[model samples]
Target: GTDFPLDAALMLQEEMKAAFASHEFQEALGALHWATKDLKIAERNKQYRELLLEVQKLIVPRYGFEGTQKGMSLMLMAFQALGYNDDPTVDANTQAMNVLISMDVAGNALAERAAKEQARTSAALKPWEEVPWEVKKVEAP
Candidate 1:
């Protein structure tokens, strides 16, 4: 309604605070998206733009594909948590969430495969195969 950018930034900040306090990762991710949108509105030179980008990147995991998909999935989950289905508008939100969930599942599978490939490549380069080092190893005390 009022200057979408400014409104989005304020709303996003509020959402981010609430999500952090409530331990809602999904909501936090959604709030991060709002912050990104706000950055676009405030322009690249804005003081908060860098902070917003930093926060967005902070939530990402080591695996790029997995991180992206997880962030997207969290946003979808947050939308569902916010009772978006109750909105009077079209069923777009609900439909989109379903699609996001499916995509996330597929993405996770792909990431797993990629991780395996990376490990294989590393293992191939290693000289000592006698004492093998696993990619994702479970540490014991």
Candidate 2:
């Protein structure tokens, strides 16, 4: 028996196949974006996380985040790559969105914050300050 999210996996597979066959890379990417959203909802499930990571590893490379710890999915990573590091300075109003998103009711709050803070720090650092070895290696090509 398979240890995968059978329904979601199969549906995504079929959708990807159809999109690729039709030369609809945009449609395929949209499908992947939704898949990532669904995976986030089921983050407690390791398989779901793996699936999302796999898709991200596959998709982000084409867009040029070839190597980074934060993975290539988040919007911030791309922005950072283009040199939009540093905290977006502004009044408290500008920080509200991030502050709200940063709150974690689960025990993983610290973990979440650490991840976000790390990403922010990484972003703020210039390319020379980035330690390539510190970033997690993508197991996939």
Candidate 3:
């Protein structure tokens, strides 16, 4: 069998591009923009946190780690568009940290899923045990 090496980085990049191009992501960004405008510091902080948490919930289960990473990366990339620039009201560093934590959690989940799948596959492929003597017995010579 031919072994073709997988290019993880390229695959991730493609996945990120697809996510960025999705209508759901576009709607989320639009909502983020609407949600962050004209808010007091406390309100903005709460809203931002909730929004990120919601995004994490949506991405982790379906897309796994790579998808979550792509989602967060898109969010961070659009910070300026989302009106989270150098505004004193917004804690950009903390938000970035939240994304990192989400990515780590997703990564662990993906690894665990992969391990389980591998175990299941290995068990399925195991050789059958020997037949019992009684079962194997036939007409004797």
Q: Highest lDDT, which number?
A: 3
lDDT of 2 at 88: 43
Please write out the lDDT profile of model 3 over residues 1-141, one tens digit for every residue: 112112332333334444544546544544554555567868866665565545454543443332344655654454445455454434544444444434234445545666899999877733434456677678789
Q: Model 2: which residue pairs collide?
A: none
Error of 3 at 17 (Å): 1.6
Best-to-worst ranking by lDDT: 3, 1, 2
Write model 1 residue lDDT over 99-119, tens digit each, in one string.
432323434554566689999
List clashing residue pairs in candidate 3: none
Q: Per-residue lDDT for 98 in model 2?
A: 30
Task: Kindly give the stretch of ten consecutive residues in candidate 3 with the minimal lDDT sum.
Answer: 1-10
Which of candidates 1 and 2 is the stronger one according to TM-score? 2
Q: Where is model 3 more than 4 Å wrong at Cα? A: 1-6, 40-141
Write down the TM-score of every candidate.
0.21, 0.23, 0.30
Model 1 segments beyond 4 Å from truth?
Answer: 1-67, 93-141
Instruction: Indicate the worst ten consecutive residues by lDDT in candidate 1.
Output: 58-67
Candidate 3, residue 111: the lDDT equals 58
Kindly list the per-residue Cα lDDT of model 2 for residues 19-46, writing each as its tens digit.
Answer: 3333243333334444444455555344
